[model samples]
Target: MSAPMPPPTTLEHARWERFKSKLGGWSLTTYGILAFAFLYLPIVILVIFSFNDSRSVSKWSGFTWAWYGKMFQDGQIMLSIWNSLFLAIVSTIIATVLGTLAALGLERYRFRGKTAVDSMFYLPVIIPDIAMAIMLLIFFNMSGIGFTPWKVNFFGARLAVPYSVIIGHVAFNTSFVAIVVRARLAQMDRTLEEAASDLYANAWQTFRRVTLPMLMPGIIGGALLAFTLSLDDFVITFFTSGAGFNTLPVRVFGMIKKGVTPKINAVSTLMLVVSLSLVVVSILISMRSGSEDSVTIGM
Candidate 1:
């Protein structure tokens, strides 16, 4: 054939392959850096500005603790914080218990219309927050569920908190808890439970000793998620909370309507700290339990 077709140059081919590999790696590294910067830069800025002495959020004044002091002394802010904490604690506890039982029932038992029940449980998690908020508002108003705040005297300060807000939080929080617990249950090794049963253990005993321990990690994760969601909730709480009752998020919204300030920044930063701490704890628990995927289920 024409000069017997020159043999392919191995050196050139190797060089070209190496070039392509290097280019691909560089591209991936750049993308990762850019994505991280985009996500964290704003949070960093917020945290930094929270310490600014100036009232204006955009301007960076010399560092000062005045805002933190103001945040602590502000009665409205402090009261809202307490209300948020109370609502989160109550809703998380209720949601976790109900969600755990539901998960167990669905995973362990086969019943008619199980698919439909499961879908109904998932609706809150899938629906938009605004739509759910409006629906809850309409339902509460039509059903005549009292939005009246229960007035209580706490350490000399008069406080009023609405029970309807807690109910609304529980409604959505239950779905998240169920999803997380269900994911954990689905991934669990059934052999352990079977072994317990084979050893002549009763249903309650087997569940108490084995099932509960295994499920604890997921339960904790779900509870933390529920607490975070309840603490951060705005729309549902806003719609369900009657006049004069405000959680931290609702309080923040009202403040925003007035205008943004360093005081607001301080409140936001504190909230961010709490939320981040809860998320970190949940992640750690999931990692320790060898069920990293459980953390993402609620999300």
Candidate 2:
């Protein structure tokens, strides 16, 4: 067979190319709009419906703040909120300390099986929540820690918190915090630490004065992320909370099973506000610290 020649330059070919280019642009624009609308339109609706006067979340009723007032006045809701706050704060603190240490160790040092250890740190982050919850439940049961509440006295108010739930939250949150802090560490300038060392500063002094201050933004971001995750977690919380134990997320789930109401919407809206506030604070910290690259919460 004879070799075939390429298509000749023609007016029709030029017009086809122009048509394809316009189609590409329009398609991309349409998809972009759809993607944003898909993600955020529901959130806007949720916020708007939270003000509905009627109990029906799906129906548009006259605006009223009664639901919000009722939400605050509900003792169970207030207790759940308090429990959620305490759990998140405690878990975040523990996760931040451990995660920062892990990041520092993994980033600043190298050793045998270092790669293996690094991979292990990511398991909790990548694992399914249900699987982790089951494992934690089993482990607690086998270890004789099953559903035992830690009798904690906080500000003169005695609280019985599930140790397993806190442990589970810390377990997963540590990995998230480690990942974020590691990203920050990867971007940090090591020269500051070197200079401090050259100035005859000891290890602790160097870290306290130079390293920690620079790492503060990343640490704060990681802590906030941990707090947000702990606060919003329902699966693990519900599974490990045992009978009569309720955090805000678990309580929300129970209410959802009963049915949706304007009070539920109000409570959900409050939670949304809190989660969004934490995210905003993390971003702001990164921005102010000139380390916007460190807020890798998606990791």
Candidate 3:
């Protein structure tokens, strides 16, 4: 007997299926556009208003760079900006080193209570900023570590950055860095390290020659993220900085209490640019690293 013939597709059925497919495609595309608009529309408004000639944020009188000039000229704002940069840079460096080491140890070693330690590392990342700030504040008081500034003449300008604040920024930033580096480690090929060892390279030599290069992208990305987080952090800085210390975000909050101005908009725009630039640079670096990694793996 001949195999049973399948039923022929009717034109209406074919048209219905194609229509459904097109509908689904259009629906997803529409949703994506709307979602992006919702997320970015406010940012677009902010950037535009930052250039407004008038002080009124609501009314667009004209365009001017006056606010930007004012932002730079304001002594307190300038101080805050410097403080933010200092905090971000210092915290990022410390967090990246600590987190990277943690990632390597956790990935390469099997130790008792490793699971618990790993979970604890992530606690700071998941905890609310307010809670973390409160916890840090309480800990500092209990530990007899007052919020004292590490006063130094930085680039001929004096800055009084609080030690407690630095520690607070580092505390949470380390978790973010660790998570990013650990992800990179998980994607890496272990064979390269083994090959390096087989070539009579010491542990440090293997890391310096092979592992570090592969991990550099993740390390850079994590550092950027930590820097951004520290720069933008308000709650922890506010709680930990104590008396006179002020970061840009904390200054912004203080400015808000007085009233919103075009100067605020200008500073906010500057921050937005810095943050977005860092993120973009990190992504580009990561993509380049990924390409390099693939080429190395193939070789």
Best by lDDT: 2
Worst 10 residues of 1 by lDDT: 1-10
Q: Write the per-residue lDDT of candidate 1 for residues 1-299, one digit (tens) a residue.
A: 14434338988777777887899999999999999999999998888888998888888879998999999999989998888887888789999998898888888899999999989898998899999988887777777667867676655556676778888899999888888888888888999999999999999999999999998888888888899899999999998886788889999999999998888888989999998888788878878988768868556
RMSD of 3: 5.8
Pairs with steric clashes in candidate 3 = none
Winner by TM-score: 1
Candidate 2: tens digits of C-alpha lDDT, residues 27-146: 999999999999998888888888998888888979999999999999889888888888998999999999999999999998999999999999999899999999898898888888
Better model by lDDT, 1 or 2? 2
On residues 242-284, what C-alpha lDDT tens digit does candidate 3 reach at each position?
8888899999999999998888889889999998787677657
Candidate 3: which stretches are off by over 4 Å?
1-9, 291-299
Positional deviation of residue 90's Cα in model 2 after best superposition, in angstroms: 0.5
Q: lDDT: which is higher, 2 or 3?
A: 2
Residue 233, model 2, lDDT = 96
Between prediction 1 and prediction 3, the one with superior TM-score is 1
* Model 1 CA lDDT for position 11: 87
